[model samples]
Target: MELTFLVYDVIIQVYAMLIRVSSLFNPKARLWVNGRKGWRQSLKNKVPAGGVDIWMHCASLGEFEQGRPVLEALRSLYPEKCILLTFFSPSGYTVRKDYPIVNHVCYLPLDSRKNARIFLQTIKPKLVIFVKYEFWFHFIREISKQQIPLLLISALFRPGQLFFRSYGKVFKQSLLSYNRIFVQDKNSLDLLKNTGIEECVIAGDTRFDRVLTVMEQSKEIRAIDTFLQGKSAWVAGSTWPPDEQVIRGCSDLISKWIIAPHEIKEDHLLYIEKLFGEKTVRYSILKDAPEKFTDKTILLIDNVGMLSSLYRYGQAAYIGGGFGSGIHNILEAGVYGIPVVFGPKFQKFKEAKDLIYLQGAFSITLENELKDVIVRLGNDLFSKSAGDICAHYVHEHAGATEKIIRFIQEKRFLTN
Candidate 1:
C-alpha cells in the first residue's frame, strides 16, 4: 500500500504539470476543487443527492459505448437513480459531454489515495461499475472500504493474461474484492478458474447490444444521400492520417466515397485539403462548400459526433487506425452489413481475425492491395457475394447485450 501511494504521488505530480501546460481544460479539476468554495462550487455543479446513485467508470470512449445498454437499463428500470459517469480519457469525456443519461460527467482524477477518497465521498454511489479493462486498485479499495458493491461488465481474459499467470497474484487478489464479474466470453471464464475466483458469469459484451441499438437508430446522411443517388458508396469511419493517405490514393473514377477521420482538427483538415486540393472535400455538417463532388473526392469530415451513424450509409466500409496499431471498432462496420477493409496489422483485435476468416472482410498488407480490392469491389462479378457474407457474420453474433443486461438486473444492483 505504501509503495502504491508513493508511485501514485510521483505520477500525479507529472500529470498536474501536464494539465497545466495542455490546452484543454482538465476534466478532473473537480478533484482538486476543494478549499476554494467558488472554484469547488463551480467545478462540481450540483447533482441530485437523495436518489440511488450509480457511478460507472470507463477507460475511454469505446468502453463508454459498451456500458451504454447497462446505463439505459438502469435509467428505464430505476428512473429515480442518479447516474454518474467518469472517464479516464479526454476522448470519452469530450465525446460524451452531452450524453442524455448521465447527470454528472467528469474526469476520474489520476488515481491517488486522496483523490479516490474525495471522489467516492462526493458521488456516494450505491454501486460502482467498471466497464471492461479499467482495474484501478485504489478506486476499488476505496469502494470496498466504503461497503459499496463493485461490478465489472463485458470483461474478457486469456490464458497468458497477467491475472491468470504466475506473477499476477497481487492483481488477481485485488479482483477478489468485486462482488461479481460479468465477462464476455467463455475463455475468460476458463482463465478466471485458474485464479480460483469462480464468482463470475459469462454475460457477453454489452457493446454488441449497444451497436445493434445504434444500427436500429442509424440515420442516412443528406449529403451522402445526394452523393450516392445511384453509385455504391464506400465509407471510412474513425480513420487516422495513414488511413486517409491510402484513401486518397484511390482513383477518382470509383463510384463514390465518404472519408471520416477519427480526428477533425484544423491541421488534419489542412493535410487532407492539401491531398485532395483539386477534388471537393465536403464539411459534413456545414455542407456549404463548393459543388465539385459530383466527379470529385470528399476528403474531410469536419463534423463531430456522427462517424458511427455514417457507417450506415455505405455498401463497403473501412474503419480507421489500423496502420498505427489502433484498430477502431470493426464491429460498428460489421453491424451495418458491409464488407469491411483495413490495414494488415490487426493481431491485437480478435474480431478482425474472426471477420477475416468469416470470408468477407479484407486485410490488406500494402496500399496497392487496397487499390486492388477497391477496384475489384467496383467490378460486377463479386460485389454482393462478400457483402452478403459480411452481413450474415454480423447477424449471427448479435446477443452480447441481452446476456449482460439480464445479469445486472437479476443481481438487483440498479434496483432502487
Candidate 2:
C-alpha cells in the first residue's frame, strides 16, 4: 500500500506538471491552473467558519447535472447547512460557478496529500459527496480519516475499470472510504459486492430526474420557433467536426437543422458556417434579425447552456462526441420523446446502450446510416413509436434523486 501511494503521488505530481505546461497553449488547461491559484485563500474568504457544510465534488458540468437533483433536494431539506460545490474541471466551474442553488462554488485543488488535508480542514464538511467517476485517493483518504460521511452518488462501474483489476487493490481500497455508494445500475452494485465492498446500492441515475425537471421548466426560444416556422427540425447537439461531416453528407435528408456544436469558439463557429454554407444562420444573429434568416434552413447554435432546452425544438436529435470519445448526453433529448442518433462509439454509456436496444436511439458510423435513420424518423408512425420508447425510458428511470435523498435521511448522514 505504501508503494502504491508513492506511485500514485508521483503520477499526481506529473499530471499537475502536465496541466501547468499545457496551460500555455490550452484554454481549458489555463483556466484549470489559474482557478487553483490561491485556492486556500479563496476557500478561507468564501467558506464561512463554524457552519456545517455539505461538500459535493463534480468532475465536470455533466457530473454536476447528475448530482444537481440531490443537491437541490438537500437544499430544500436542510436550508441551514452550507452547500459547497467543487469542480475538478474548468468546464464545470466556469459555467456553474454562479449556480444559484449552491452557497459556494470553486475549483478543487489538485489531489495532493497536503491540498486534501488543508481543504478538508478548512471546510470541515459534515458530509462529502462525489458525483460519478471522481475517485481522488488523497481526498477520499483524508475525508475518511476525518470520519466525515462520504458518499459516491450516481456512480457506475464497468468490468474493465481499474477497481476490478488485479493491480487495482489500492484503487479498490479507496471505495471503502465512502460511507455509501449510490450507483446508477445493478451491475455496479454487483461488481462492488463481488470485490467484497458491500456498501453500495443501485439508485439509478439522478440525471433522469434532472432532465425531467429541465423539461418541465423549459421555456420557448422565440428564435428557434421562428427558424423552424412550424417545420420540425432535427437537432444535432454537441457536434464535433466528424459529427458535422456526417451531418453535412446527409444534409439533403434533413429539412430544417439545428446544430449545437460542443465548442462554440470563433474558429469552430466560422467552420460550421462555412461547412453548412450560406443557409446556416447563427442563433444570436437570428434572434436580432429573424426576418433576414427566413430563407435559411440550418440554424447554428454558437453558444452554451441551451442545448438541453434546444432538444425540444426538434422532431429528432443527434447527440455528438461518439466519433471521438463517446456520445454526449442522450437522455436530455430522449426525455423530449425524440428519436436520437449518434456515432458508433457508445459502449461506455449504459443509457445509450439501453436506448439503442429499445429502438429509441440509433448509433451510426457512416453518412448513409445517418441518412437512413433520418428518413426512418421522418415517418410519423415509426418516429412516434421510437419517440415513445425514449420518453418512457427516461420516465422509467426517474426518481433516483428521491431514492438517494431517502437513504441519506434514513442513514442520518445529514441532521435536521
Candidate 3:
C-alpha cells in the first residue's frame, strides 16, 4: 500500500511539472499553473477562521453544472454555514469564480499530501462533496483521516474504469474513503457492489434537475425571438467543425439554423462563416442591428452561456462533440421539449441512450442520415410526439437533487 502511494505521489509531481512546462505556450495550461500560485495564502485570507464551511470540488465546467443544484440547495438550507466551491480546471473556475450562491470560489490546489493537509486544516470543512469522477488520493486520505463526512454525488462507473481493473486497488481504496456515494444509474451501483463497495445508492442524475430548473426559469432572449420571427429553426449547440460540415450538407432540408460552435475563436468563426457563406450573421452583430440581418438563414452564436436558453426557439436541436470525445449536453435541449440530433459517438451518455430508445433523439453518421432525420422531424405530429418524449424523459428523472439533500439531512452531516 505504501509503495502504491509512493508511485502515485511521483506521478502527481511529474504531471504538475509537465503542466508548468506546457504553460509557456498553452493558454489553458498557463491558466492552470497561474491559478494555483499562492493558493495557500489566498485560502487563508479569504476563508474565515472560525465558521463552519462546506467544500464542494468539481473537475471542470461540466461537473460543476452537475453539482450546481446541490450547491444552491445547501446554500438555501444552511445560510449560516459558509460554502467554498473549488475547481480543478480553469474552465470551471474562470467561468464560475463569481457565482453568487457560494461564499467563495477558487482553484483547488494540486493534490499533494502536504497541500491536502494544509487545505483541510485551513478550511476545516464540515462536509466535503466531490462531483462525478473526481477522486484525488491525497485529498480523500486527508479527509478520511480528519473524520470529515465525504460524499460523492452524481457519480457514474463503468466496467473498464480503473477502479475495476486488477492494478486499481489503490484507486479502489479511495472509493472506500467516501462516506456515501450517490450514483447516476443502476449500472454504476452494480459495478461498485460487485467489488464489495456498499456505501452507494442510485440517485439518478442531478443534471436533469438542473436543466429542468433552467428551462422553467429561462428568460426570453429578444434577439433570438426577433431572428426566428415566428419561423421554425434548428439549434446546433457546441458544434465542432465535423458537426458543422454535416449540418452544412443538410442545409437544403432545414431553412434556418442557429449554430453555437464549441470553439468561437477567430479562426474557427472565420471557418464557420466561410462554410455557411453570405447568409450567415453573428448573434453579437445581429443583436446590435437586428433589422440588418432579417434575411440571413444562419445565425452564428459567437458567445458562451446562452446555448441552454437558445433551444426554446428551435423546432429541433443538434448537440455536438460527438465526432470527437463524446456528445455535449443533450439534456439542455431535451428539457425544452425538442427533438435532438447528434453524431454516432454517444454511447457513454445514459440520457442519450434512453432518448434514442424512446425515439426522442437520433444519432447520425453522415449528411444523408441527418437529412432523413430532419425531414422526419418536419412533420408536425411526429415532431410534437418526439418532443413530448424528450421532455417527459427529463421530467421523469428529475429528483436526484431532492434525494441527495434528503440523505444529507437524515444523516445530520451538517448538524453540530
Candidate 4:
C-alpha cells in the first residue's frame, strides 16, 4: 500500500510537470501555469494571522456553481469567519476569482505532501469544504492529521467508479478522511452505505437552488424582446458544431431561433453567419440599435454570461453538449418554465431524466426527431402543459441549500 501511494504521488508530480511544460504553447495550459505563479504568497498576503478561515475548494466552473448556494448561505449565516475559495482548474478560478462574498480566490496548490503541509500550515482553516468530487489524498490526509473538519457537499457516486472496484481499497480509505459527506441523491447514499461508509446524507442537489436564484436575478434584455418581436422563439444554448448542424436542419420551422454556441471564436461565428446568411445578427451589434434586430429572425449570441438569462425569452429550449459528454445545464432552461430538448446522451443527468418523466423535456437522436418534437411543442396548449411541469419540478426540488446549512448549525462548525 505504501509503495502504491508513492507511485501515485510520483504520477501526480509528472502530470503537473507536463502541464507546466505544455504551458509554453497551449493557451489554456498557459493560463493554468500562470495562474499558480506566486499563488502561495498571494494567499498568505490575503489571509490574516489567527483569523477564522473557512476554506472551500471546487474543481471548475460547474463545481463552483454547484457549491455557490451553500457558500452564499454560509456567508450569510456566519459573517465573521473569513471565506477562502480555491479552485483546481483555471476555468473556475478565472470566472469567479473576483466573487464578492469570498475574501480570497486562488488556485489550489498541487496535491503533494510538501504542498499540502505548507498550504494547511499557512491557511490554517478551521473547516475545509470540498465541492463535488474533489478527493485529493494528500490534502484530505493533512486535514485529518491537523484535526480540521473536512466535509464534501453535493457529492454523487456510482457503482462503476474506481472506489467500488476490487483494487480500490486505498481510494475507499480516502473516503473515510471526510468528516461528513452530503450527497445529491438516494442512489449515491445507498452506494456509500453498501461500501460500509455510513457518514453520508442525501441532501439533494444544490443546483436546483442555484437555478432558482438565477431565475430571480435574471436581467431583462431589451434586444431579445425586439428580436422576438412578439413571436415565440426556440433557444439553443451552449451549442457545439454537432448541435449547430441539427439546429440548422429544423430552423425553418421555428420562427425565431437564438443560437448561443459554446465556443464564440471567429471561425464559429463566421460559420453560423454563413449557415443562416442575411438572417443572423450578432448580439454585440444590436447594442446601439435595438430596433434593427426586429427584422432579423435569428439572434446569434456571440458572448458568454448571457445564456443563463436568455433562456427566459424562449418558449422551448435545446441544451447542447449532449453529442459529446453528457449535457450542459438543463435546469437553467427548465427553471424558466420552458420545455427543454436535448440529444440522446442525457441519461447520466438526474434532472434530465426527472424532467423527461415529468413531460417537461424531450430527447431526440436525429434532426428529423428534433423537428418532430419542436413541431409538437410549438402548439399553444402542449407548450403550456410542458412549461407548467417544468415550473412545478424546479420549485419542488429547491431548499437543498437550507438542509446543508441546518446541518452545519447543528454541528456548530462556525467560530467568531
Candidate 5:
C-alpha cells in the first residue's frame, strides 16, 4: 500500500508536468494550466467567511450536468448556504464558470497532499459532494480526517472495475472516506456491498432530473425551426469523425439532416463542409440568416450550447461518440421523445441499455444498418411509438434528484 501511494503520487506529478508542457501549444491545455494558476488564493478570496459552505466537485461538463440538479435543489432548499463548484477539467470550468446557481466555479487544484490540505482548510466546507466517479485520494483522505459530510452522487459501479480487483485494496480504502454514496443502479449497490461497503442507496441517476429541467427550460429557436421547415429532420449530435462517416454513408436516405460534430476546430469544420458540399450551411452562418438554409439539405452546427434544444426539431436522433470511446448523452434527445440511434459500443451506458430494452433506442454497428434503421423510423407509426418509449423512460427515471434531496433532509445536514 505504501509503495502504491508513492507510485500514484509520482504519476500524478508527471501528469501535471505533461499538462504544463502541452499548455505551450494546446489552446485547451493552456486554459487548463491558466485556470489553476492561483486557484487556492482565488478560492480563498471569493468564498465567503463563516457560513455553511457546500462544495461539489465534478470531473467535466457531463458530470456537472449530472450534479446540476442536486446543486440547484440544494440552493433552493438552503438559501443561506454557500455553493462552491469545482471542476477538474477545463471543459467544465470554461463553459460553466458563470453558471448562476453556484457562488463560485473554478478549476480544482491538482490532487496532492499539500494542495488538498490547503483547499479543504481554506474552503472549510460544511459538506463535500463528488459527482459521478471522481475519487481523489488526497482530497478524500483530508476530508475524511476532518469528518466532513462527504457524499458521492449519481455514482455507478461495474463488477470488473478496479475496486473489485485483487490488488484494489488500497483503492478500495478511498471509498471508506465517503459518508454516503448514492448510486445509479442495483448492480452498483450490490457491487459496493459485496466489497463490504454498504453506505449506499440505489437512487438512480440524477442526469434524468437534469434532462427533465432542460426539457422544461427549452425554448424555440426561430432559425432552427425555419431550417427544419416542417420537414422530418434527423439531428446528429456530438458526432466524431467516424460517426460522420456513418452519417455520410446514409446521407442519401434522408433529405434533411442537422449535424453537430464533436469538435468545431477549423480542420474538422472544413472536412464536414467538403463532405456535405454546398448544400450544407454552418450554424454560425445561419443563426441570423435562416433564409440561407432553404436550399441546404444539411445544417452543420459549428457552435456549442444549442444541441439539447435542437433535438426538439428532430424526428429521430443519432448520438455520437459511440464509435470511439463511449456515447455522448442520449437522454438529451430521448427526453424530447425522439428515437435515438448510436454505434454498437454503448454497452457501458446504463441508459442506452435500458433504452434499447424499452425499444426507445437502436444501436447500429455498420453503415447499412444505420440506413435501414433510418428507413424503418421513417414510418409514422413506428417513429411515434419509439419516440413515446424514449420520453416515457426518461419520465419514469426522473426523481433521483428528489430522492437525494430527501435523504439529505433526513440526515439534517442543511444549516439553518
Candidate 6:
C-alpha cells in the first residue's frame, strides 16, 4: 500500500510540473512556481532560526484561511519560534507568497517517500499542523516517524468520507499519528470516536478568527467607505453566474450594489458590465469617475483579494455560490453584522445550518422568492432586526481560535 501510494505521488508531481509550463505564457505565475525554493529560502533565513520551527500545511486557499489565525496566534504567543507554511496548491502559495509571519512559504512537494524525506530534512519542523481535510498518508507517517508533535486544526469529518468506511483502517491509522485532533464540530467528534479515535476536542473554526482579524484591518477602510457613501450596499463576494442572475433580478432600482464576479477575464467582466450597462462602475475606472461617487449606483470590484474586507461596507451581504455552484463563506459577511443570503444548496456546511437556525442567514431555491426577501429588507425594522441577529450570531460563535491555540500551547507542542 505504501509503495503504491508513493508511485501515485510521483505521478501527481509530474503532472504539477507540467502545469508549471503554463507559467511561460503567464510570466508572473512562471516566476512563482519555478523560483519558489531558492528565492523563498534566501528571503526566509534572514530571520533568527535556532528556535522552535512550527510548520503548518494546508491544501488550498480556503484551508490557508482556516489555518491563518492559528499561525498568527502562534507568532504572538511564541515570538522566539520560526513559522513555516507549506501549501500544496500554487493558487494558495502564489497569492500569499509575501506574508511576513511565515518564514518559509513554499509548495508542499508531492508526497512521495523521497520528496517527503527531503522536506523533513530541510525544514525539520518540531511540530506539524495540518489544516482541515488535508491528510496525506505518506506525509503523515513520515512526519510521525520523526517523533514530531502533530496537530490537526479545525478538522471536520462526515460519515460519507473514507475514514468512516468499512475498509478505512489504513487511513484511520494515519490519523492515529496525530498528537491531538482539534475538530470543528460535535458531528466530527462523533465521527472520529466512531472510528475508535478518542484524542479529540471541539475547537470550532479558525476562519472565524481570521475574519475578526480582517475586521480589525478594515477599521479605517477608505476605499470601500467612499464606494458605500452611506447608502445600503450589497457586497456580493466570490459569486458565480447563478448568484449574479438572482442579484440582477432584484437590484435594478436599488440604491446601491456591488458585483464582484469570481472571474476577472476580459470577456467575463465585459459580459458583467453589459448585464447592467451604464449603471455599473468598475474599480479600475475609478480614476475617471468624479472625485466623489455618492451617485454611483453600482460598483464592480474587478480585482481579487479585496472582496472579503469589502463586506464590512455592506448593509446586507449576498454570498455567492449555491444553487448548483459550491457555496462561498457566508460567515465572513455574517461576522460584520450583516444578514447573509445565498443559494439553496448548502448541505455540507454546518455553519450555514446554525446561522439559519439563528435567523442570521437566508437561502432561496427560487429566483422569485429572492425579490420578496429583498423588498422585505427595505423596511427599516426588518433590516435592523436582521443585522442585529447576524451580529449576535457572530458574537456567540467566536473564540475557536483561542481554544485551538490553548490546546497547542498546553501540549507544549512547539519548541523554542
Q: In model 3, what lDDT does residue 305 have?
A: 89
Off by over 4 Å in 6: 1-52, 220-229, 287-293
Which candidate, 1 or 2, would have the higher TM-score against the true structure? 2
Worst 10 residues of 3 by lDDT: 45-54
lDDT of 5: 0.90
Off by over 4 Å in 5: none
Give me the candidate number with maximum lDDT. 3
Quote the positional error of residue 181 for candidate 6 in Å.
0.9
Error of 2 at 5 (Å): 0.3
Arranged by lDDT, best first: 3, 2, 5, 4, 6, 1
The sequence of per-residue lDDT tens digits that candidate 2 reaches over residues 265-315 is 999999999998999999988998686787898999887889999999889
lDDT of 6 by residue, 65-175 (tens): 998888888898888777888787767887887888877676776566766775676677888899998887778888889888898989889888877787666678888
**What is the lDDT, from 0 to 100, of the residue 102 in candidate 1?**
73
lDDT scores of the candidates, listed in order: 0.74, 0.92, 0.93, 0.89, 0.90, 0.78
Model 2 Cα shift for residue 67 (angstroms): 0.9
Total clashes in model 5, counting residue pairs 3 or more apart in sequence or in different chains: 0
What TM-score number comes out for model 5? 0.96
Off by over 4 Å in 3: none
Instruction: Say what the RMSD of model 3 is.
Output: 1.2
User: What is the per-residue lDDT of model 1 for residues 215-264, given as tens digits with 9 covering 90 to 100?
Assistant: 89988666656656667778888888888788878846456677787777
The clash numbers for all candidates, in the given order, read 0, 0, 0, 0, 0, 0
Give RMSD to native, each candidate. Answer: 3.6, 1.3, 1.2, 1.4, 1.6, 3.2
The lowest-lDDT stretch of 10 consecutive residues in candidate 6 is 43-52
